[model samples]
Target: MIAYRNAIQLGDWIVTTDNSGGIGEKMDDLVAVPDQITARFATRVALLEQWAAGAEPVAVLLHNFSGNASWHRYCEGIRDVFDEIGITMPPISGSSETNMSLRQSAVAVTLMGKQKLESSESTGDWYTYGTPLVGEEVLTKESEIASLTVLDEARRTGLIQRLWPVGSSGVLAEWRAATGNPDCDAASPLDVTCSAGPATVVLLQIDKEKLPNAKRHFGTLLHALR
Candidate 1:
């Protein structure tokens, strides 16, 4: 199974989570990235997860594992997201890794919501909204991964047939999961293999006829499955 997914199917509703790791640890010697950014980071992923699951968010859960000392600070970040959206912060819960003097930091946020994604009767062609970036690239090109502005516009426009977030397994793995076709290989214009630790990019399934909608949102960044 793909390690990172937009959301998992569960009846009419769905569940999803998005988390950040070494970035926060690296950004904050105090524990995690400024909690507000952490909150946004988690919420952003959760939103994509919700869309991938084909639903809307209802509840939330967080695993604030970025060392114990700055737990409250981390939470403040999460709260900032909910407040900005004008939605009551869902009933929240989390854990802090205390007692262990871990040198690095990590954090996880989960969201639960409802909506049927789509019928599985037919799967569409695969495309990518953004190119893959990981490791040092994720750090160097921080703005690209951090913002979901493009994704939000695409989702709101309802331009694509389906959506999935690229994760640790990278684009190639996610494409296989979506199409269930092994032996799928070709020189790709996009880096199909990179761990998008926090789902920095999304997997888009759109037919060629609707390519314009995809293009309007993603511009030259769009990559088709070869």
Candidate 2:
């Protein structure tokens, strides 16, 4: 029998299976792990050993939406254990687009310790960080819309925005809108432009005064643009 352990998020919430054999059926209330202590692969390995017993090694699939150094480190820890057990672990996969059937199984690990798909200042904005806007896999139109929605929410939460790159045709328009200083004709040297969508390039300019605060909201974006 392929017994499976619970799905764990980076911050330490565990989604265990209930007696109904249903996957991700939250049995007990969500338990909170201490802030200082994160989950260790050793604990995961022990749980897997007990669940699988003497049966053939089960395939442990780790799903992530965003690929970052921290996630890489966590996976490396898992790999170490799998190597010790002499089992060929299943390939790790990532997807920014969501599939209804795989909802509970897909684990999202963000540095912010929040599950919401907001842009991270530390990680930088997705586009600025040069991290693929979505996962590498080709997505359907619907999935693309969903992905955009995630960004939109982030923008609304003051976590992200589609800033115009400098030197673009719309620079004047964006500047006017952002700074509300249309009468001032100050030429900006950094004339970089970012394509907001097909046939639409926005002028990108950053206000130095807002840099520090913006960095706190979307460091990845600043990194990419900088």
Candidate 3:
């Protein structure tokens, strides 16, 4: 089941759903919002007023009740309309569930427009490599160095162009071996630059506990790209 609402502020608008009840209870239900859903809602909430008056783009949070493709398509349609109207669109990320007792599935949609991003400076090319500190570290070091080379090459060729120091020593060993110079401070959580076009890349050393934080961290990296 799905419920919706719409509004407009001056000229801009928003359309949202009210599907907060347990997933099973609402799965088969469908409720239609107004035709000018996006516009009316945006206006009612003052989102359009702010945007039309040249205010910075607003951050929108959307939680989907169903993880089906049809729901995603509907969201896309609304996003397309917003894009045509020149409003800044930010990506919506959330999870969907089948029932109250069922596991949840996640869904995400990327929105575009001009807006301030928090982690802008952290954007850059990234290369990562890691080696478990186990017994007889000699063989591990050799294997780790080889793996770092692969990551370094990915950065050089632009396949993986952002840097986060999730694993520094492993990465540095590769960088040091590749350049044949120990001057490159691969240990530092600083960005490294390529002499050519995309100058500097941010390096990060990440592990399991840091995985959940990647989204926000990477979001900042992407903001820098823009």
Candidate 4:
């Protein structure tokens, strides 16, 4: 239920969306940050969901509530995420609310992608990539966040059985839910229930026998769940 929430199957396509609010350069926002950074992380979440599902993204829809002036900067942020995956920015179409003044900033990104095929099953262990980071911590701990480039390459090489992005539920929660092992008490160095904020962490199902190669492939980004 956790992994399946973001992206859904629609015949040959998968449509997914992700959102963020109150974390921008707005007067009443919970976390004060740039609009560009806000949109970038929000876009990254939706794109990662599509990518993890083996979908080739075709279009993007953005909803901007910050202000009319923030639209262009939001687009730039979205494009920045696309650049990280080494793909051309998809056509973006959305609206901006400029009629009234809003206290907090809000944004949502929806991605439409074609699912080429189903993913393979792994006969190995589950591991996490990146530490759970939320709000201001996400801005400061850039090195701990998972890499889209690395994930893209791993999916292409068939090195992972399944890829699950960690959201607000944290690593252990996602792992247990995805594996259907609700009672699993795996040793973890990370907080089991902290928010991952825009999916900075991802759960990778890799064959136990291939752990060596996975270590080489993921480098320092990989961490054990057990």
Candidate number with greatest TM-score:
4
Candidate 4 lDDT at 218 equals 90
Backbone atom clashes (below 3 Å) for every candidate: 2, 17, 31, 1
Tell me the RMSD of model 1 versus the true structure.
Answer: 4.0
Better of 2 and 3 by lDDT: 3
When summed lDDT is taken over every stretch of 10 residues in candidate 3, the lowest stretch is 1-10
Q: Model 2, 74-193: lDDT tens per residue?
A: 466445544544455445543433323322212322111112322222222212311211111212222321122232233445443333222123334444543456675434332323
lDDT of 4: 0.84
Question: Predicted candidate 2: what Cα RMSD to the true structure?
Answer: 19.1
- Best model per lDDT: 4
**lDDT for residue 126 in candidate 1, whole number 0-100:** 78
Q: Considering lDDT, where higher is better, how would the candidates rank from best to worst?
A: 4, 1, 3, 2
CA-only RMSD, every prediction: 4.0, 19.1, 19.4, 2.0
lDDT of each: 0.67, 0.30, 0.31, 0.84
Task: Please write out the lDDT profile of model 3 over residues 1-226, one tens digit for every residue.
Answer: 0001122223233232222222122334232322223222222222322221223334544444444433554355445545545554555555444454323322222222232212122223323333322122322343332122333333334343223321223445434543346675554332332211101122332333434444333442321110
Any residue pairs clashing in model 4, and if so which?
Answer: 124-208
Where's the lowest-lDDT run of ten residues in candidate 2?
17-26
Residue 98 lDDT, candidate 3, scale 0-100: 48
